[model samples]
Target: MKNLKLAAAIAAAVSCGPALAQTEIVWWHAHGGQLGETVNSIAEQFNASQSEIVLTPVFKGGYEDTLTATIAAFRAGEQPNIVQVFDAGAATIIGAQGAVIPAEDLMTQAGVEFDANNYISGVRYFYADSEGKMVGMPFNSSTPILYYNIAALEKAGVEPPKTWEEFESIAPAIVDAGYIPLAQSHSPWIWTENFHSRHNLPFASNNNGFDGSDGTKILVNNDAIKMHFSKVKEWLDKGWYAYYGAGWGDNQTPFENSEVAMWLGSSGSFGGLLNSVDFEFSATYLPYWEAITSEPTQTFIGGAALFALTGHSDEENKATAEFFKFLSSTDVQKFWHKETGYVPITTAAYEAAKAEGYYDEKPQAEIGIKQLSLPSGDNSKGYRMGFYVQIRDVMNREYGRIFAGETDVESAFNVIEEEGNKLLDRFSKTN
Candidate 1:
């Protein structure tokens, strides 16, 4: 009788083996630090809420590093099921025809009622086809805003600038008061975004890549941008600004530490800034160049989106789609936005949070939502181009040259246009 019992137990164990194994989905991403923790927490929550799947969140370094690693992995047939690509990498992923599965189609096939109307127009437009089919899921979306140390400003007896002219005027006074007037990173990508937005200029032709196949190249040499860079150089010379090295996360430290009075950084920096600062801080809309226009245009959103990979079976794809739907639900989006300082992707999530007084309790958090909701013109929606990551590197190099006094503004811009255009051409052709 004991031998018969042992045989029955073995048979039961064998029968339950496959049922006990959960479907593991790997998510490759560029998030780290607090944002990384948030990603893991979301994955944990999802895993606990379901029995069929488990998501593993893996940090693959910064944005550029993550994209490079993903490409290498894909070539080796070892790519993860999902990867987070930033706005700049949108065109590259779209160009990878056989490599990606559109998220809209995936969700539909999974039997989830995925509705495009649920998402904000700006967020959806960035990741969708011309026909409004979503290519990826919007994750951590944000816009650039002016972060100010209110205490520092009060100490200097200067009000936060409401216009570009006022912003420039206060620079000298802040420095005279022995404070860093501006804490801009030495990285050019941030400046590129700032300059384009301030001047309300198109970074590239074809509505920054949403318009046409033959997109043209434009850079910082335009009159409005030239004037902006020249002003920055002047600030640098007057000791009004200090350059933090091109380290990915070091730039915001000065602002958080209250060493600098003002900074222009992503709205997503809200959480970290809030946690680290003891002094009073406030967020306002990004200042615009007074010469460019009278009003502020919508600033582009930064942060990453989740792209579904090709080559998975229909069942696997369906599972991935289910996960995407899970992510898009109003509950998940509100949780993500509230916890991570990322802007909500859906209008419903935004309105829901507002009704719950989420923004009233956290005033600084409202800046991003206000900035993204402003009317979008050609200049506002953000830039999308193949090889944008590489082009940004080139811009950074040229800006360093200018900062080092190796070249003047015009000369450096000339090099930027030349190098940047070459890269754009290469990516355009290959893509």
Candidate 2:
């Protein structure tokens, strides 16, 4: 009887003993709606792939909002294990000093195999520090591309323009065909910043703040920039370009209804557009000025990256590294690239897409990749200025003043330079 009771007690203890506790890692992100669903699916898959970690993806509003929340959370010692920060916020997060773990260190310390060179040059350097150390994991990268309605272009008897001059020549016909020739929301990242980078013009001093951010100055008053603005103002005046104010989605409805023939939008919009549009459409590289250069320079990236925060337990950090490793896998990357229109982050993912003939079936999807694959120039490296998001806001406000006839192009840019320099100075002081 004693032996029987002892065996029963042992069996009970074994059954009740705590099962392995999963290290739950919360990931705050800005992806919402369909993209949010996709993000959740990724988390689910990663959780199923391992029993040691449970990734919980939380929707934390838009990019700016998410960054703000992360900063607040960090101050309170309640930051999530991981946060998705937009490209513009890269410098701000990096300059925060000990706010987050460097991705290279995170992977190395966790014993995960990490190769920073696996990321493409166009994207790899954008998130790297002064000494070329990657501070964040590149994810959901995109370049600005021009999307055009094929039927509208055909009815207008013109091909999509490859050059700014060609676009000017074809604008009248597109307008006469009873369609808005072009329209874009107030995205200076596409119009001013990337334009400068693509033409090898300096948007700011100190190699666009890549060398150092201490004394960077705004430099948007060049003749090339002025000429482009002059043409845009002319187009707006002639009713060839429609102005929809300063919000991101204000012009999307017009384009989707086929009322607008062409618009400058993110390459990330391709997947959503495939489901939203009834009209046949295609996308191509952002039009460039032939006079500015012999060929178009490599365009910079816009989109967010995954950054690991500090103050997490070692096990939690290891789980974050595991998630990052999963994200870097070729299969995962290919799935992400196909599900979203963003460029694949790794060369292996791109090769997988090519071998599967995915790009052939949807050639428009590959345009952004081809553009980013082009050789990077000295000026086209990428923007790394402090408070870049605020700088973009300054640029957009000046653009509104120019379009509303409140200010001339040169004067508006001068205002941008003065106002933007103040913001940069403030950021430099804080860092």
Candidate 3:
């Protein structure tokens, strides 16, 4: 009877199967609002699809704030498994090689197949190294595109601008039509980062830092950038432009509130802008200075990428790799692109969406992808400067002087480059 009982217990154990160890993998991210919710949804879907790994996404404020928290945690030896860093900070994160497991290496170590060819060309390369080894998973990739109020343009009898000359010509009429012409923020993003890329001008030497650490100096004093700042100041004086002091979606408010007729902002604003405004609007490629360049060769990336933090268990890293594979799948990428305004990161996801007529259903949505898909150049690939946040702060202070008409473009540009380079040097030495 005892033997029968033992056999019954063994049978029951075999039938029930071994326990599924729910390894908790924490993800720290910077996105908030609807975008934040979308992130949570992705985590939930990933958890439901797999039983071994459970992901918990913790909102860590803006990109800067998230970086601060992650650094603190790392110092405390309590770092999360994953972190999302903006493109501007990509260099710093990549520089901290000891603290991170490059996404490519992590995937390889976990025995996951990750190919650089799988991602959207422009987006993928932004997070990759000189050897094309992906350092992080390109999360939400965007390029600045021109968003305009259709009714305002039509009312002023002005076609959408294809060149800076056209924008200049239409500025007066747009203002006269009871609309602020351009709603630009006083950030380094539109005024500096995207400006260099749109014109195919190098922001730094050595192929805009794509050739590695050789190109660490600041190059903002170039003719193209000086020309851009002069133009911006001119527009501001003419009331053809208004200054907003935020980045990303903050530029959207002026357009939605009828305070401005046109704006240049991240393409990730696509869905948010559509939801925020009840007006006829359209998107186009960023206008170029016809004098400097007839057309835009390519534009740089403006979104964040996903990096896996080091000092975690091998099992946790494996689970992180699995989660990334799931996120990079065609279906998830497609849904993410549709749900949020970010373009798909993977080429297969993009093709799948196009085959399903995603662009036809929403024509304006293609503008960003089109802008990014333009012919590439060394300058347009992206920038890699250490302590980029400090450089941006230096730019913001100098740009404020430009907006206030307190300093001329040449002087401001000179100061920005000098101040920015100092931080880069300090970062190089200490970090």
Q: What's the lDDT for all of these models? A: 0.78, 0.87, 0.83
What digit string (tens of lDDT, one per residue) describes model 3 on residues 1-431?
64674465446545646785567899999989989989988997786676677799999999999988988999999999999998888887888758888889999999998887888777877887777788889898888888899999989999999888899998999988999999865368776777787778888865666555543787888888787778888888888888876454566687889879988887888898888899988899888888987667777678899999999999999999999999999999999999998988888988999999989888788888888888877677778888888888888888878888788888988898888887777877865
Q: Candidate 1's C-alpha lDDT?
A: 0.78
lDDT of 1 by residue, 1-431 (tens): 64664465446545657766556788998989878888887886676566667678899998879988999999999899999998778888877878889988888878888788888866776777655588879898987788899877877789988777897788777877767988765345456765575456778776666553355575556777777777777777877777675664677888877778998787888887788889888888877776778776776677788999997777667778878888887888999999989999988899999999988888889888887777777676566677777777777777767767778888878887888788777877785
Candidate 2 has which clashing residue pairs, if any? none
Candidate 3 residue 15 C-alpha distance from true site, Å: 9.5
- Model 2 CA deviation exceeding 4 Å by range: 1-21
* Ten contiguous residues minimizing lDDT sum, candidate 3: 5-14
RMSD of model 1, in Å?
5.3
Q: Identify the candidate with maximal lDDT.
A: 2
lDDT of 2 by residue, 1-431 (tens): 64674465445545645586668899999999888888987887787676667788999999999999999999999999999998889889988889889898999999999988788777887887777788889888998889999999999999999988899999999999999999886458888878987887887887778777799887887889888898899999999988898887887778998989998888888998899999899998889999888767888788999999999999999999999999989988898999988899998999999999998899888888888878778778687888888888888888988899899999988888898899888888997
Q: How many steric clashes does model 1 contain?
A: 0
User: In candidate 1, which residue pairs get closer than 3 Å at backbone N, Cα or C atoms, i.e. clash?
Assistant: none
Models 1 onward score TM values of: 0.89, 0.93, 0.92
